[model samples]
Target: MDDQRVSILERIGLEKPLVQAGMGGVSRHLLAAAVSEAGGLGTIAVPGAAAIASELAAARSMTSKPVAVNLLLPFARRSWFEAAAAADVVVTFWGTPKRRVPGIWLHQCGSVDEAHAARAAGADGVIVQGVEAGGHVRGTEPALELLERVKAALPDYPMFLAGGIATRTDVENAVASGADAAVAGTRFLLSDECVAHPEYKQRLLSANSTILTELFGFGWPAPHRVVANEATASQAGPSGEIPFINKLINRASAAGARFTPESVQRRAVAHQSPTSRMLTPHAPSEDLPRRFVEAGPLYAGETVARIDKLLSAEKIVTSLVG
Candidate 1:
């Protein structure tokens, strides 16, 4: 690695150039700490300031290694940034380039243009996400293809490649293609530390194909890739419009957040917020809500077809690095 790249990695305490993607709800304390402990960058996904602080603290308690926090810029409130600034690294996704963060900040981008924007906005690095990525995809092209394009455009910039990465060879290929690191979500989702419901993990294990749809577009109206399920099948014809009532609910939530006390908002953002309930993984003790299983988004990447067994987060990181 170049000195610049090495410095960037060191800033985030990455001994191995592998990142456990910050999958909302799924990438909580246990999973993040495991990856960090094993030498890769582990990221916790949370939206509000309090949740970010608490999760970071939890991860810190497990490992002295550096940890990162991910916040979806579109959903982040001012309080989120305040809390995230204390983390070793802050990663933002799904929004235009903006640097309201302190410390080393990285932005996940979908295209060359977005990568340039991120660089111009003073991001320490950029994660180029391809269409094949799980959850909310940002790029229209394949992961490697997008990585090559962005690398060509910004040859000296520190970049991470995300999408369809499942094995050690995938990580090697990403590094050979000019990526400083590789980010994996679907592979980590199957890790023992992930909080994904047993049923959800089983569905991923059995799924052989994925589809992009706007079915779970209540709060965030964007195309997300997932295994085909009853929820996806029910949406006949074009993606139906988000219900007016749901729109009202989303608006009300945002409005309510502004007036709500910081302590209350912190609690609400993770549990009661519509976005959290819709996207975050439910507790393992909760029975797999059939309605959610049928309709809620089961985000996975194209690599889902290749993963079959669950492993420890540390094992997953070792396998990818080896």
Candidate 2:
């Protein structure tokens, strides 16, 4: 590895250039601790301040290795950032670039402009998330394609490649393409450490396809890629295009977010708001209601088609870094 890559790995206390992406609700102490213990950087994703603090503590207790915390800008509360301060690294996504944690802070970006803005904001690194990535996508370019663009714009900057990574070759290719590390979400989402519902995991085990859609926009109406479900089937046409009314809802929701208070946004997360009918970023967890399983978004990356089995977090780490 080059000095930039080596420096980032050393700073984050990682042995391999791999990160198990922080997933909302799905990623927790067990998964984070396991990934870190297995020599890859692990992250405790957002739930709440108490949950973050508790998960961070539990993860630390289980593994002396470094563990990171993820805070989604749209859903993050001040308390969430405050609680994440105890983590080794704080990873932020979406919104304007800003440093919320004291330790190594990395911002996940979708474009070169976002990467440059993150650098100006004093981020220690950036995870370049491509549109092919699971969850809420922010960039239009392919992961490696954008990785190179970001590299040319900011040489020596620590960059991790996200999206389109599901195998060892993908990891190696990312580093060869200038990424300091490879960040995988869909692969890890299928891991045993992840807390996704068994039905959800089973669904992805055989998943041969995925679609990008704006139909899931309820709490946070953003473009997200997910496997087709009853909800998507009912609304999206055979071409996967949502009806005119659905598109209007997404546009209105995106516009409303600008004026909506953070408190109200947080309330919507609990399914207690006027827009509770829409979907947030939450993946299906244990007993999230059959209604959710049938209709809720089952976020997966384009690479989900290749992941056929569940492995322990440690094994997943070893596979990615192979």
Candidate 3:
């Protein structure tokens, strides 16, 4: 193994080549801190400009180990990146890759081409995301295949594997396929430390399948994965595609969100249209009502089928590395 490629894990101060994916809203301080304490890189998903500092501070107080932050670039403003400077590393998702954070930065890419773009953009590494990833569908293929292509193109670059990660074998496969670490979101989302709604967890527990759709794309018009729910069922045709009229509306909403003032967005979130009522790019935290959660996107990966039980954040890290 090349020192440059393998040393990325060491550079990140990971005891095990495992990373907890920063599930927005779901992976907060307690969960991120616990994973870091367990000897892996724990990541706090970017909460907001107002909360990033406090969230990182809270995680720092809990664990002396390194903690990272995940940012969805579409909604992240320049201030958000500036506010995230405290994290050991900043992991960004979607949109063009940029070096906003001064420290180590990584971008999640859906394809080999995107990985190339990240490298050219001076990203420290890339998280190769497969379409099977929960929360969002980026890559059109499975995780390993995407990793393979990325590895082939940039064999010496630091890389992390996301999607299709639920077992020890999956972690092993990721490393064997040239990933420096295995990034797991769905597994960690089920951890006791995660603040995901109890009802959301329960819904995912019995979920054996997931569907990729744009039903939840009000503020962000990207394809996402979610368990079957009334929200999806209502919009999906027999083939699971949304109708033309709704697609136009979703596209308009996505465009409008770009120019939509934050205050208006907040009000919209507080009083969402019935179509995406109680939904955000972030997963539903415990405070969301069960009724809304049931009708909203149940973001999860295909690995969800393999996870039938919830574990502590530490135990989850141990189980994946073991």
Model 2, 107-209: lDDT tens digits are 9999999999999999999999998999889989888888889999999899999999999999999989988889999999999989888888888898899
Q: Write the per-residue lDDT of candidate 3 for residues 180-279, one digit (tens) a residue.
A: 8899999999999998999899889999988887777767868888887676667665445776766666677775565567777656555543355334
Ranking by lDDT: 2, 3, 1
Using all chains and alpha carbons, the TM-scores for the candidates as numbered come to: 0.87, 0.92, 0.95
Task: State the weakest 10-residue window (summed lDDT) of model 1.
Answer: 277-286
Residue 115 lDDT in candidate 2:
96
**RMSD (CA, Å), each prediction:** 4.1, 2.9, 1.8
Candidate 2, clashing residue pairs? 218-278
Candidate 1 yields a Cα-based lDDT of 0.80
Error of 1 at 146 (Å): 0.8
Candidate 2 Cα misplacement greater than 4 A, ranges? 250-277
Which of the numbered candidates is closest to the native, going by highest TM-score? 3
